[model samples]
Target chain A: MDYKINVEGQTARIKLGGRLTFSHHREYRDVLNQLMSHKAQIYEFDLSGVDFIDSAGLGMLLIAKQHAEASSAEVVLKKPAEEVQRMLKVAKFEKMFNIIQ
Target chain B: MGVLANDVQLEKNQGLDSIKVKGLHNNIFVNRESVEKSESDIKNSYILVVDDLEMNRKVLGKHLTKAGFDNIEFAENGEIALQKVAESNFDILLLDIMMPGIDGFEVCQRLRSQSCYKSLPILVQTALDGDDDRSQAFAAGATDVISKPINGPELIARLHIHLENKFLVNRLTQYHDRLADELEVVQQLQQDLVPNEEQIAAIQKNLSLRLSAHFQPSSEVGGDLWAAHELSDGRLSVFLCDLTGHGVVAAVNAFRLHVLIDTLEEYILDPGCFLTELNKRLVALLPVGTFATAFHAIIDPRTEKITYAAAATHTVQIMSAENMQINILEGDGVPLGILANETYETIQIPFPYGSSLLCYSDALVEVSDSQNRNISNQTVKEWFHEAKLKKVDVVEYILNALTSCGITWLADDLTIVSVSNETE
Candidate 1:
């Protein structure tokens, strides 16, 4: 998977692409680490470019949540494709993080 | 001989102290001891020198023997060379092209024809003959060719290179064979975890249901697991779980689930509670970012309901006899081992007679057709209709349909289950 991170003051924006499965954990961790080190108050993950998310990929999001919350930051998932949105809904992501669009 | 020892030491100096050779058939790994075993490796090599003249054989054999090769054989002609090679396990062949009757080129061709000598290094001796002879020697499967009035050092160097490669390949083949044997044993154990045909037959008979399933693990063992048990309440509870990885690790996780299921019987009656407790246990069992997606359901004839709870599994498909329209049961919850306190929600639907529920792993949907079109709910309903009309097992029917549509490969384990209440 490919991702671009942009930090602007209090908010950090991430544009992730391709498949976000366990195979992409290294790249995903890099992105998380890069953004988390900024200590932004909010983190927005734009997943419109992501096509698939396996069970392990979903766990990665939880890990991301834990990392962000540890630093008192909020995470928002934005514009996920229909299938990703459906999967997140099925996994009860609403209880854990805020999803938009 | 000392020059041959430097060959392995040089390769070691390149920072590859231990070679990790994988994908030499079934992801086998072999590490060659290039550093310490270099001296013994040269001494243990078997060399065959074939020449029409005894003078040439003696000279070549003496050169090889001086260069730490103690095991040497002689062949006066190509025919004897072929015979000796067939009888003995020669590591390398030193051949003379000037030999009469089945020359070195023909010997190379004949030996190359057999699978056993496929990798044997054939070093052909030429008279600095034209490019045609050298190319012909290569075309006939000569590994390397040396010039006549052979340089002793050059012959030893060529022999050392080929022998090193041959030994590495030998180690790889040995490791691959052992891995295949071990994987076969584990694969059988994995199959044992799945409910056998006799157990399934009895369960279907007891429920008066037509049940069918299709399970195919990938080349390596995967984490897909499933079981059906007759509960004490006279209800049939079925559960399927897929761990996140493949190979031996996934197989171990499947075994762990089997152990947990065998001990946790009380929660099996209630899908939600069962999954909640399973999640709690798995959270402690699995490592971070490693989790299992699961779907558990119980068929209750008394209440005429099929209640199920799921953890990030594919949407369960249900079709009734009335309209044959596919009903989608949304499977929603965090996967097991992700959170310690996550609780699955139990969803109940009518389990009238002649109704069938189709449950499958994500591979079914993830597998796109030739047009790259994903399987949708409508497409599934159509497939279900065709299977019902043809009176074929839905699991097999859909898999066949997918195969005919050019989906001949699966990257992950696949599982499909069809359970019908046929008590009408």
Candidate 2:
């Protein structure tokens, strides 16, 4: 998946698009770096553009949340696609992160 | 007949009777290639000097000894030269082309025919001006060609090149063999991590459940682990866990999970709790940024239901035996080890008689379809039903179904386990 991160004030909004799977670790690392670089109180993962997400893609989200939580930052999953939402719900990410409808 | 004052041959001519060198130039670095120990193996190199005449062997041996080549042997004919090499290991062969019986070319060809002497360095000593002999020696498998009336320094220098390259190649081959053997052990260990055929047969003996599983790892050692255990409560508990990446580290993590799962025997009937506790244990056990997507389910014959909780896994499906209608199970929960305080939802569905529950790793659904589209859960379901309708192997049908869909290679390990409450 391709992601564009925009940090304004204390909010870091990461817009992730396309498919996210095991092959995207290299690109996902950059987003993790962006999240750690710009410390923010609110980190939003814009997953609405992601059409499909496999287990590895979900694992990447968990990785992001772990990084975000370490800094006492709240990682919010924002605007997930229906399929992505179903994937997150199946994985039960609601317990870990607050999904923004 | 006047040699240089320093014992070096100053005059070069054929009339003075050049050393009639005869030996087999062959790649003899075989079988015991990498066994050479110590840095002086090259200098302490055992050399075989072959010639047809005693004068020739003595003359070359003198120059060889002067060049610090102490370990030397001689053969008066090519036949003896071939026999000596066949019996013992020589670092290099200084072969003389001119011989009475078994000429240098014939001896060299004979040695080359033997696989052991394939890489043995055979330096053919001949007339430097004879292009025909030089090419023929090379064709007969000579590692190199050195002229007769052998210059001591030139011979030593050429020997050093062949020996160094030969040893270096042996070391590389040794390292490669070691890695292959280690990987084989790990692959076997990975195979052992899952339940074996005997265990599956034991489960089948219960008569309440028909179980079949297939695990095909990609070219590498993958992190897919699955097992089936008969619960003390007359239930069957099975789980499939696929770690993030593959290879040694992922394999080690799988071993850790295997050990941890054994400790969770108390939660055999509770699929949700089993994963929750497993997740907590994994969080403490696994390093940060690593996790596994898994599915744990308990099959109860009394209730005829399957209670399962999935952590981002795919292919949690159940096929009805009556109509062969495949239903998808929503694998609910976050991946294990990602969150310390995570709750996996326990969703129970009816497992009517003649119904089968399938839980597989994501590798199945991630493949492309026949139309070049990625095979999703829906496509897999259709393929499963198609397999059942045709009365063929479901897993094989579905896996091979993607062959025309551009799934020429398995991108990841494919693992699937099915438990059917046939009761018949």
Candidate 3:
């Protein structure tokens, strides 16, 4: 997966493109870890550029959100790709995470 | 005339230093120290003495036993000699060509027919002094021809030659066996260096890379190497390298390149800067006159842009997405190990949804037909046209073309990697 991070003050926006499978988990975790160290209460994850995602990738996002919440940072999903949106709807993660279409 | 004590003393001193020997029809030298050590081992180095005359056998046996050889078995004729050879392992065979039952020629041929004694050294000790007798002995697979009465020095020299040859043969076989084992390990290491199938599939889905690869080493070890890793910024960096030589030396350099790439993956950010660091490391570490041709490119899937750089490599071609038109990417940089602190420039190419870029080693182009003719670029271009610009199976097609060109074996290591906009 390709990642582009735009950090504006305490809020950082992350954009993901491609498949977020096990191969990308390490790099994805690193991006989240970098975000968690900040004093921001909100972390924006943009998935519009993402083409496909598997269950493992969804689990990774949940973990990232949990970690962000512990640090008083809110992890929100914004502008998900068509496939990603369908996956989130199927998993019912849209209710737990603030998923923006 | 009476011999002086000084001459006797000189002979004794010479005997202490060296011994002239012949074995397997070849002259050999044996150091005195080694001869002493071999006495114990001689027990296992048995000999088969074949002669029609019992006296000849007895005298020869006594001579061998005096020389520290322990087991000397006798065969009265050629027929009996064949039987004895089949039954046991004998290091050397002493045969008389004029044997009664079966001539030495017949026995030697029979022994040679069997797989057991194909290389067993055969020395002919006979009273028949004709040139024809000597020729016949050789034709019968005789290792050496010694006319009686045999001098002790000649006998010892012939035996030493045969044993030395045996030791050398065994040593060479052992060396080759070890090389094969090491090749297996190197192959495993090469496999580990490549990104696994699952990883490639994952990256394909993300970057839409229309990537295909074919890696075949001509020998047990080769120099062609390639690696792909996702950068921290989500861009994928794919590198393909071919070291200067092939075999063990090339393999070592390829491994070193792997380590350099791993280190760069952890530390370096920009593709150009990464190559600079890699080149510096290679120049410092690799021996003079040795270098590598490398192509490193980073593809940002989100931006649909690629920053590509090459060092002493064939140009990377970008096929237009709309049509099959090709644009060659020419990156100017000296090959690794050629310059110090040399900065390399990368060309930013807009990789749209349906196009792909192809990077290949010189081996693909450096091919000659069966008549030893260079394969022209026009032929390659025609092949590209036939593939419909979709390089999903281009590797196989190119290899098949090269094979048809009469180039049965690749002279150098070959590597080809293509990243196209994934249509699937």
Candidate 1 local lDDT, B1-424, one digit each (tens): 1243322212333365464322212222335464245436657988888998988888888888887788998999989999999899888898898878988889998988999888888888999578988889889998877788888887776777666666766766787999999999988888888888888888877766677777777666778898888875557888988888566777788889889987778888789999999999999998766788899999876666898999977657888878777777777778898779888888788988778888887767766789988776567667887998887788889988888889988767777788887752
Candidate 1 chain A minimal-lDDT segment of 10 residues: A22-31
Model 3 C-alpha lDDT per residue in residues B211-258, reported as the tens digit of each score? 666666556567788877766555778888777656777788888888
Segments of candidate 2 deviating more than 4 angstroms: A1-101, B1-40, B52-69, B96-106, B124-126, B129-140, B144-154, B366-379, B391-393, B396-411
Query: RMSD to the native, candidate 2?
Result: 9.6
* Shift in Å, residue B17, candidate 2: 50
lDDT of 2 by residue, B1-424 (tens): 3333232222323443332211132222322223234125677879999898888889888887886789999998988888899899998898888789898888889999999889888878886557887887899898988787777776765666566556656677898899989989889988988888888888878757878888877656788899988876568888899887666777888888999998998876788888899999999988765788889888887788888888876568889767788878766667898778887778888888777776778788777654667677888788777876786656667667777566867677889787778643
Q: Candidate 1 has which clashing residue pairs, if any?
A: none
Against the native complex, each candidate's DockQ, computed on alpha carbons, is 0.59, 0.41, 0.01
Q: Of models 1 and 2, which has the larger DockQ? A: 1
Per-residue lDDT, model 3, residue B333, is: 52
Give all candidate RMSDs, comma-separated: 3.9, 9.6, 21.2
What 10-residue stretch in candidate 3 chain A is worst by lDDT?
A: A87-96
Over 4 Å off, model 1: A5-14, A22-44, A62-76, B1-9, B14-16, B19-39
* Stretches of model 3 off by over 4 angstroms after superposition: A1-101, B1-44, B196-202, B205-207, B230-235, B266-269, B376-379, B389-392
Q: What is the TM-score of chain B alone in each candidate?
A: 0.91, 0.79, 0.85
Which sequence of candidate numbers ranks them by TM-score, best first? 1, 2, 3
| Each prediction's TM-score versus the true structure | 0.89, 0.73, 0.70
